[model samples]
Target: MLARHHDPIAAIATAPGRGAVGIVRVSGHGLAPFVQALLGRALRPREAHYLPFPDAQGQPIDRGLALFFPAPHSYTGEDVLELQAHGGPVVLQLLLARCLEAAQGTAGAAGTAASVLPHLRLAAPGEFTERAFLNGKIDLAQAEAIADLIDASTAAAARSAGRSLSGAFSEEIHGLRDALVHLRMLVEATLDFPEEEIDFLRKADARGQLSKLQHMLATVMQRAQQGALLREGIKAVIAGQPNAGKSSLLNALAGAELAIVTPIAGTTRDKVQQTIQIEGVPLHVIDTAGLRDSSDEVEKIGIARAWEEIAAADAVLFLHDLTRQNQPDYVAADAAIAHTLAERLPPGVPVIDVWNKTDAAPGVQPGSAPGHEAVRLSARTGEGLDTLRHLLLEAAGWQPAAEGLYIARARHTEALRAVDAHLMEAAAQLESSGPALDLLAEELRLAQNALGAITGEFGADDLLGVIFSSFCIGK
Candidate 1:
């Protein structure tokens, strides 16, 4: 809990640089004295007063509107003050310096100094929200949502953050936690006096509660995954033999010559990546060197790097040249890649055969392969690009109504997955060996803790620091 100190914390609560107005914010019990010193007069809470802000020597710094918000109802659950002034960087800096000077000194009578005063310090990144959390103004989940709102990249991301800030995510977690507690209470009551013969653990109602808990957690995990995908886009890698039109496909998809197209083989001995948005979904398109056997040290090194890239990619596009007849070298190249990636690629990674250069070849239909469903198109002419786009979207499970998606990090997705795993384990324990109630209870508790980490109900110290410090100042 935050200490109810008389001291105040101050910061420029608006973004830096030029704007219509810049806001210098202060919050705590000592706001009254701080305001009087800076404004050259006392101010009534919840009222906006126009006044000339003064420097340390009583010289006028700037004329601005001052606002006061009394304690227990303000953002930090403390008395808050806001000075709205010209937004120029230089002017704001001078204004901020004067405010700090005013906060540090004795209490003032009109424009003169008095004996007693309150101490104030600058707010750190996310510190104001942290204080809000400490003071019960907002919960851990809502506090994190505030930071997410500031960093949202898309409209859907912003909306999801807003929902979480409004306690949508927290409400779900709390509901689950409440159910767990009820079940734990029932189990503990039975285990406390086994001789009662009531058999409380064998009741149908207990099983129903366990089942419902599992189902609710599963639904939340799925939604969290979607939100994470919307927040952090997938990494798609393009890999194939040399001269398979990989570079051309990259250029076509990216709408620019991001990579150099050439007829010569082994031209690209490095990986090139371009970020493109398809129907609002960001795709990190990585073009890797053509996978092949090479004696040249540089080419071999690039080929090695290409394998690493393919292994890390969310999906891989295996490009093939349809115009050229199947040759032994091409067959061997494809075979080598297939054997190398037998265990490396994640399950369900879309490995589509991309048939490029269809315009140069005659009588070949520009479509998928025979019984293989390959995407046939001319990368140079932009044919079948739309088909490829649709395939990518389908592979990602993207839908038209994806506005419900929330932005989540990989750590968040992993945590949710771990929660799901534990919940399932707990469900299994509920029915085994006369109901291992203690282990089952522990598993449910662990599951709740994992979910809690996503919304900051429970988090490692380093993680809390990392999450908040990443925020922009004045946020």
Candidate 2:
């Protein structure tokens, strides 16, 4: 896989389909000659030139702007060429094909493109960004952020991804790494002089330094956890008995009539989904079919699917009808749902009691179930929704947004956790009655390695492949 990184790659850099403009990009070592060969004229470095990209027969494939960036200064630390042309698919394809033909020593009407760059081929998905990472132009974190920024579901997510791309997250990792290195050096120096090992670490304030490092890691972990929430929002499933205002709550939360709401029971025969953001944290709220024992075959299927969704939910909003509190049958059905919730809900998925239609039953004190948050709201009047939104965010484990936050992934949080554990081990070793300098040193080393993995300072080729393979072609 590493050997494949050396191959020159070309790709259409724009999103698929028609647009006002599209881009065809190529990156490789010593591409200046290739640029001249393909364009029939040498391009000024880092300058855009108006030109017509010619084919093997020298006919214009598309007239557009071509820009060149020389090696060690480009995105991949290699020579790069970009052609901005009309966004039509066929026009970009012809230009790309011409570049390939020219790479194979095919001569156009004006000049020969032979041997300028050999073995030119189509870029694999994320190959372009992967090269940038491998070449040290951007670290692994920043490379991942490129995709994150593109796939961001909210403005906050996009901003955080941009911060990460600008190396905000990498900078934090580097800071932790530098501190760890200093502490490692101090411990190793102490190990070298066994006669005064304890006293040496003692005078150097190594414990104090380690304490500071742990504190720093904690801050990063908290920020990364919140950022991961932005990247990966939780699934929130709304469920209850028929006419319990399940669809009404969903519509109210989504601020649109997404789910069909009626006085009739089983109006929603399927799930209605909407992605709503609370403080820039996305929640994929799904209103599943009401749960009940239905004789109709179709209603039974819907109810079964509702259980499926309930089992899979990150948190279940078991909405209860406030007006039906006095009805004995309604109470039993609600209890049945609570039992199924306990039986089927994945462990750790919170079950919140949402008392709907509070406007009709003002000041109704619905009995709160022992392990679930109770919220009273009138979905029709849009009251108590703010409280529900806050509770949902709380249930998702999202903290208040921190300043200078950067988007992070699940792997990042896991890596940080590993670093924290290693640091804790090192601290314990330091605090031991007869601390083994070697164990302390080893723990610190592992912690640094974990930190290095976050920014590509330490990682395997397979890890690199998995990270970059997730990106779209042409970065």
Candidate 3:
């Protein structure tokens, strides 16, 4: 009966391509009859039966184990079936066809056709998780956590994602919601009584409650920002004048020649990006075109794009040649470039100066710190790379802790920020002599709604569709 939401979805729950075992999962109403059509019997719920998957005309296409999960306890909270078959692409296709045929033919207890069944629909990216959210099996934040866990590149990232999936993030939001609800009750109570007897407006306790709520919201928002950083990582761009060893540095840091390096000024025109994990922090290293004035149309376009990259970069590496230091023009050029780029870069973006090719210049060792904040390094010799890495991590505000982190996305962080904003507004209203009760209540409601979005409590059907559509078909 639950299948009325749409078509039943199917997809290979296992990863694509060859494996020791492949699973094709089907979930929705009328799934039992479909399984019976192939297995040829009424199998007990939650029981695994080794049966031959029959094709049309009751012919066996492949033999495998079939497990039936009755509705209400299944992953999708619907009648679900799993057919485990040999990991052959063709073989799995045949089994899927058999399941589809069975699903199409089954009728519900009602005389009408079981149109509630999803008609063998394709599952979107994260549809199963979406269904689980709709069924109250998990909240919205947990559903997003599933995606983060799948895409985690480091152990810390995965661990954080797992914690989120386990409801660490949602629990905090729920706690905040409970506090807000209680505060709203006390504030609204003042409206029900006569002004003279209503001591609510003058109560010190009410003001204290508002203060506490604001502090709590601020704390949670700060942590959510840090969690987002760990999940999204940073985009660090290497930008400088031509032949400043940008390509060499990219190769050295990546431990591979991802970019072509030569004495040629425009050897690197396009951007090359490598996602690297340094001690579990995901870093997106972008090697951009060397910023310079060019006459060639293509090179000019590339240089302009390089500046764009620099503008958006979380951090910029303004590399320079150390040997050219004595030349007055060289010093003026570097200073001018730095000042110009600073105007274009986003506010708060940290630009680190890197003096490369220092091996050729005496008194420049990997451990030696330059008079400026810049680091002296030889990308070719792999010296001072560690210092650069540490600096990048420090810029990200990443500090290794024994535990207590969870994976979070920018969306989740935004929601938390929204909640914090509303809470602050509510606090401000409560403090006013003529209590802005209406505005305070409205802000409290907004805060609750923001928190609800994290767990699917405030999401729309279309939002659910978009979220779940990303999952594999049979998931």
Clashing pairs in 2: none
Q: Give the TM-score of candidate 3.
A: 0.90
* lDDT tens digits by residue: candidate 2, 129-218: 888888889999999999999999999899999999999999999999999999999999987799999998889999999999999999
Among the numbered candidates, top lDDT falls to 2
lDDT by residue for model 1 over 305-350, one digit each (tens)? Answer: 9989998877778788776645777766676766566567877776
On TM-score, the candidate that comes out on top is 2
The model with the greater lDDT, 1 or 3, is 3
lDDT of 2: 0.89
The reply for model 2, stretches above 4 Å from the true place, is: 293-304, 342-348
Error of 2 at 9 (Å): 0.4
Q: What lDDT tens digits, residue by residue, belong to model 3 across residues 231-294?
A: 8888889988888899899889899989998898898878889988776888889888877677
TM-score-sorted candidate list, best first:
2, 3, 1
For model 2 the local lDDT of residue 350 reads 92
Model 3 regions more than 4 Å off: 1-6, 106-118, 194-198, 201-204, 362-373
RMSD of 1: 3.5
